[model samples]
Target: PPRFTAQNHGNLKNEEEKEEEEDRRDILAHRGSLTVRRWYPVGTVLAGLYSVPPLNEVVAPPPGMATRLCFSVEYRHSCEQLMVSLLRLGNLPPRFHGNIMLVELRLLPDDRRPRQAKARRTGPDPEFCDCFVFQVSGVCVPQSTLSVCVLSVEQDGKRHAVGRVLFPLEGELGQAGRVLWRDLETEDDTQVPCSELGDVQISLMYSPCLQRLSVVVLRARGLQLLTDAGVCVQVSLRIHTQVVKIKRSFVAKCENDPYFDHRMTFKLHSQHLDEACLRFELQQPNNVHSGERPPALLGVLVLGPFMYARGPQLQHWMDMVNTPQEPVELWHGLGRAT
Candidate 1:
């Protein structure tokens, strides 16, 4: 069932307001000047059995100073599906005085049969076949600490707990917090291979009061896949805000190979944004289009930008291409210039 809440809606509004202010500043600073460049890498793997670290980390803001956090995740593997949830916990200094601001969940590969394992072979049915990558971005709230948790679940209802790194308001640079993988539990009766699942989980904790940020990466392995079968990858993003109370979600899917069909979806909270404009393109080797024809274009529906306080506002953009109607040619720009 789809999860929706009032608190989530409020957060979305706060983020929208913050984003609008930033956009206004940018536009005023560079009037009549719009620089649209490809910031995310192409041919990026979105789904895989392995785990990759977030693109960047947040720095601790000075005590009482507001800060922003930014990160991303990529997956490149032939797994049945992938699900990611981002959680934010607040108030852990002396007394738990803060609120749980955000809980975002992303469901990737909108269409696909529930994955089922094939009959086991002889010794050790190859383990660790699902791979994925993720990136997270957000701003630090004043007078609050941030904690992030990434959980990866596989087919057959097997749940694997990655790692949980903590960011404290006051702590040594390297002594923030560590995730104890050995302490995590697995649902399958079979003993989970420690090496494969060791570093699959990644977490980032930040404290505005102390102005400190800590990042940790966890990995794990299970359910090997035959290389002969081509792989499909999916990616999704969910945003949750407390100030304005909004929950926004974006989903995309694509095949690892360029010759297959892929689909993408964008979902947003209704009360947050006015409208979302999305441009899709295909970049080929030697600056060519994917096929003989032009690429298709689409737009995302957003209620408008939600308002927020001092920190950076949350804005939505499609950094990656989940599916292309035709093979993308080597050229980058918004929707084929009409």
Candidate 2:
């Protein structure tokens, strides 16, 4: 018995490593806890296919001249497994053109809420089909208000106002993927006349984090139009920077308050960050009206944060009155305890 091997094989290997750490704390206390749900698609698209005339009859840009719109959207995914499942779920936003995808172009605020169905998957497969084709151009800033709220659209029906065009900032309407109002010759310019800027009620809000794209411009009431036309609308807010070449910028102002509300907050602090392209301009100083052209409200870039974490998670527990079970006082004799 005294020859029971090397110290009884180190006491049976420390009793099988304390029984595998108590069976991994009884299988992590019986597991279970994980629930994630995500869906988006909010609709709105009614400019009557570019014939321009019915936001009442366009006459809202005489205060300080501000309305030069150019909005564009062209997304086509009839198949190819839903564009490779929307480019592997990054929601396709980069180069994205043909099998088509431009996704967003901004500037809107009549009442702001046109698009519909911001999200829906309900888990299990859900028969996918996504389609979109929106095109907007500017130059009707009197009283100013242009909105196309389709946050997510492939198909839901009920977006018909079709009546506005011929303001693509005056010229150049060929590039952004091509759609030049039938080669403009000059029928009042080209197209602009459509009514029914009504019936827009869309709602679906859930935020863990990630919803930044808030642009507001309100000065219509009595319209002094930027302080009685001393003229100063120079507002520029361009976004899309991950320091690739370095060109960061941000500025805001409407002055003297006819009405100005601008808020653009996009968050995605990691993966090197950068997916919120914005470009706003209202310079206007060639003596006010060189030839009448300032009415642009292009907007639709809403991808907010819901679960972006590079920081925020710490839990260290172990204090029990400064933890001291056997260290028995080093200065316990100072005044001798009772």
Candidate 3:
């Protein structure tokens, strides 16, 4: 061992830090599937937070309120874009002070379940930085882009579009330690076309006489090629905390715009119709052994008591409501899950 002054001790510490960082990088060399890669932070977040109600005032939350949110993304592997992620949002708004926000991270082009961080703030902006520090094991490649979305969580637990940010990895990191900040933009700032994610079509008919709700999956469009080409469906019914799930067969890999000859029917009781819900999910099943890879979510439709009164769900709801005598067909744009 060589002895030295205070400068040598400082140099030793820096060398240790560098060695640790190299160890972490070696561990992260393989990611998409293996669970061996541990979760770690990217760095400090540089973000600009906002609110439509003018966040400078004091606001208190009402009693007995809770937030329910799911940030969903129908995964897409390629489109001449990047694949990256921000640090995990610790929680929605991190603290409650009458602030409303929804935090969502979209990375898996193959997962049906949306990953999210949801919470409510009861006052003005926090006394410190309200940064959403996201983390991931594998997505730090060149030209890869990560999306950070902030939506509004309503009292009824539905998420509405609010604002979003895109982090482009290339040329973003000038030095190894410097983090940057940017502004978040809402739909009002710019209109984003829905056709980017593509669409799915279905037909529905409810027969009071037969006491059944019938659904026919027509087709899906604009899905990522080859990898996510083969798809399947899952239909579910929930009544009084009890759930019934049915998994359908997968379409052929050759069918990009898949059409199913499949028709799903559910028995409905008049008394439960007021409180029942029907859910149809488009999923890309895992091809290898179970747990070898996570499945991606293509799209999903939830039909509930008040669903038809809403936008896309309503488009089909009213069509059948007007002509209960026949089945109604409609196409809907696929949206991000969260």
Candidate of highest TM-score: 3
Per-residue lDDT, model 3, residue 53, is 49
Model 2 worst lDDT window (10 residues): 311-320
Give the per-residue lDDT digits (tens) of candidate 2, residues 223-321.
122322332222232334332221112222343222333322333223322332222223213335566855332111122121211100000000101
Residue-pair clash count for candidate 2: 63
Superposition error at 298 for model 1 (Å)? 50
Count clashes in each candidate, considering only residues at least 3 apart in sequence or on different chains.
Answer: 78, 63, 28
In model 3, which regions exceed 4 Å deviation? 1-195, 225-229, 291-294, 307-309
Measured with C-alpha atoms, the lDDT of residue 242 in candidate 2 is 31
Give candidate 2 misplaced runs (Cα > 4 Å). Answer: 1-6, 21-27, 30-99, 109-338
Give the TM-score of each candidate.
0.15, 0.17, 0.39
lDDT of 3 by residue, 12-100 (tens): 89998887787677656643434443445344445554334432232222232222122211122243323232222222233433455
Per-residue C-alpha lDDT of model 1 across residues 1-338, encoded as one tens digit per residue: 99875578788899988877777666656655555232222233567746654312221112331111112222223342122212121112221122111212222112111122221111111111222222222221112222322222334443322222222222221221221111111223223433321112222233333322222212112312223222222222223332322222222222221232233333433332223222222222122345565322221112112222111111111101111111111111111223
C-alpha lDDT values of all predictions = 0.25, 0.24, 0.51
